[model samples]
Target: MTRSTPTKPQANPGAKPRVIHPWPLRLTHWLNAVAVVMMIGSGWQIYDASPIFGFTFPPLITIGGWLGAAIAWHLAMMWLLVVNGLIYFLWSATTGHFRKIFPLSPRAFWHDLTAALTFNLKHEPGVYNAVQKLLYFGVLCAGVVIVLSGLAIWKPVQLWFLTDALGGFVIARYVHFFAMAAIAGFLFIHLLLVAMVPKVLPPMITGGRIEP
Candidate 1:
């Protein structure tokens, strides 16, 4: 008599959904990264030309060789940033991306903040922890402020209302500078966390595998 082989178990189709970073989110994220780098570099060059603050960024670190070149690059990247931002916002709104960062609670934030400071925070793939949500929200607000301040600086005469609301060109410049600082700070911490948690990098690049 011939012996029969046992069947292997199949995956459950109704199991919990997997975490994915979705293509649209990934695309917008990378484009934003490129735009932010170019904008910041060129902006630094422009700042060096007529700095509001005492110090200036190193020439080597800045984009464009001169003020005029920097202005050109900055203007070009501005459009990319604006358009891409709009697309990201629209997509987020339509696809319920905002849900991930909503319902922020001070209690949760405090708890997570403590956990993070103590290095006890655990990262869940595809889910934004309280601290993460706050950071993301903060950056989004900074992005809007930066763009508006940039516009006020770029077209003070035409956008006189905006410039006036921001307390004129000088004040607008300050606002713009601080906004850039906020973004730079966020980027620094963001990169540091990525370095510490290298595994998280792959999911952002490749829509991560689902956990049961």
Candidate 2:
């Protein structure tokens, strides 16, 4: 008689659970959010001191009372953003998270983009899509530009080379401002996307179901 082959156990159809963000990433994420908020508020106040493009943001939403206070707040939040950003990047790199956020090839990215645009994008529970990876990588680069430009303008004489490379003090200042704007825009888009996929937020908050 012929022996029958054993089949693997099947998962429950009702089971739709997972573990996404880990403790370290979640911690850094929240910290980074607070830091960014602080930076934006103070930055607006500081900008009021020298109204860029002949316009100034209203005081109602601005953080600091004056230029001096804004400078202090901005500097304080800068350190927090920089330190936590560094830690998050380092941890993600070491833990293989970087690979998950970066597409393996241009062809793969093109395929993903076409799928997304056509509303045929496949959603993997905890995997980053090509568009998501591109956005994430772009944001990372924006962060680096902001930090470098901020430093260049903060001490033009001390960071002379950076200032010169960026086409002097005024250019560096403008770059910093635009970089902040890019990040702010990203925040709104990110939130909108998160709202569309409600399940993703819960995983980010509670670290998802570990054994589901």
- Most accurate candidate by TM-score: 1
Supply the global lDDT for candidate 2: 0.87
RMSD in angstroms between candidate 2 and the native structure over all alpha carbons:
3.4
User: On a 0 to 100 scale, what is the lDDT of residue 148 in model 2?
Assistant: 97
Q: Where in model 2 is the C-alpha error above 4 Å?
A: 1-6, 10-18, 104-107, 110-120, 210-212
lDDT, candidate 1, 2-78, per-residue tens: 99999988788779766679888988899999989999999999999898978999999999999999999999988
**How well does candidate 1 score on lDDT at residue 149?**
100
List runs of model 1 lying over 4 Å from the truth.
1-11, 14-19
Error of 2 at 89 (Å): 1.6
Q: After superposition, how far is residue 40 of candidate 1 from its true place, in Å?
A: 0.7
lDDT score at residue 75, model 2, on the 0-100 scale: 97
User: What's the lDDT for residue 42 in model 1?
Assistant: 95
Clashes by residue pair, model 2? none
Per-model root-mean-square deviation over C-alphas: 5.1, 3.4
Model 2 earns a TM-score of: 0.86
lDDT of 1 at 121: 90
